[model samples]
Target chain A: GESVGLHLPTLSVQEGDNSIINCAYSNSASDYFIWYKQESGKGPQFIIDIRSNMDKRQGQRVTVLLNKTVKHLSLQIAATQPGDSAVYFCAERGAGAQKLVFGQGTRLTINP
Target chain B: NAGVTQTPKFRILKIGQSMTLQCAQDMNHNYMYWYRQDPGMGLKLIYYSVGAGITDKGEVPNGYNVSRSTTEDFPLRLELAAPSQTSVYFCASSRGQPISYEQYFGPGTRLTVT
Candidate 1:
């Protein structure tokens, strides 16, 4: 009965501002967590990932923070742009698991 | 590299129809996976394969079957399509074992079952 879920179903942010998308996972055994971005009419693309051992990981203009104690994960995008509009999903995989469990996803819209 | 590729970008099928969803990867990855994305929802695992000739059922594998004959191909077959089977199907691949979590996804095939 493992489940990964997001805090919000939809989020709107100013184009030049920062955006944060949160996720809460139920499986404490999950050791790996990933953030994926899905643009319209396309498959989900890998954004960033963090392991339970690490608290945060950064890439380009994005950052992923993992709070294992609270079973929460977050993806932060700096200087959000129009191109950042998409559905963002968080997925988790337990140790030695062959597949990942994905959350329902958050629709992130960048406002001008 | 072409990465992961799936055939039939879009399809419409009648209930009880059968079809095969083709997936191929040129990256020479040992791990392949099939996932279905429902509207306003996330992706659900249908099946997965680790290397050629090795297949396993995933979280949602009730109406689907998969075969991994070669490292490059892993096809998912639908025996009797139903309305609930309509969704966007994505194929993904990654290096198996120690480095298996960072997956590369395909463009996806949208199927509508009426």
Candidate 2:
């Protein structure tokens, strides 16, 4: 079975500071990776995604870096805001897998 | 498009009870899925359907059953609810294969079984 894991369970950062959440996947064949932001009492929202062919991808104020060599993925948030306070999760899908496997998730707290 | 909608936003079931969670999508997507989220745990796939009349079990399909009689609806059935089945359930749909396509999720249905 494939397992996705996050390095940090919780991260606290001051507003306007950069926040990085790390994730590691066990399957090397996993090619598709996605970052999701789940706010309190809501379903997870898609942040961004990267394919194995690409090492990096960026969204409005977020960036996802994929390091297939080390089976690692990271999401970077710029100028974190109070609205960004939520649980972030990284999910991976193997080449021919039917569904994605999600990590435990990292709780991000933004300090005012 | 009302991308994905789930009925019974909140439900409380007693032990040995049976109930169904309803999910409907207007996007006319071919892929639909059901997942459960537990406290401090990631979302676990319960069931998925590639198209109408084609349903399959996912990672955590033990206590659940699903049917995709129509392309727009996929309902999950719990035969005998248990405390372990208490969790938030989400319904999602994608335009294409899940491996390469993005899935849109609904608000979710919070279920509590005692």
Best by DockQ: 1
Worst 10 residues of 2 chain B by lDDT: B94-103
| Model 2 stretches with alpha carbons more than 4 Å out | B98-100
Which candidate has the highest TM-score of all?
A: 1
What Cα-based lDDT does every candidate model obtain? 0.94, 0.92
Q: DockQ of each model against the real complex?
A: 0.85, 0.79
- Candidate 2 per-residue C-alpha lDDT over A1-112 given as tens digits, one digit per residue, 9 for 90 to 100: 7999999999999999999999999999998999999999988899999989999999999999999889999999999999999999999988887678889999999999
For model 2 chain A, give the 10-residue run with minimal summed lDDT: A93-102
Question: What lDDT tens digits, residue by residue, belong to model 2 across residues B34-109?
Answer: 9999988889999999899999989889989999999999999999999999999999988766434678899999
lDDT per residue, candidate 1, B74-98, as tens digits?
Answer: 9999989999999999999989668
- Give Cα distance to truth, residue A82, candidate 2, Å: 0.7
Q: Could you tell me how far off, in angstroms, the CA of residue B56 lies in candidate 1 after the best superposition?
A: 1.0
- The residue ranges of model 1 lying beyond 4 angstroms of the native Cα positions read none
Query: Against the true structure, what is model 1's DockQ?
Result: 0.85
C-alpha lDDT (0 to 100) for residue B4 of candidate 2 = 93
Docking tier of model 2: it is medium
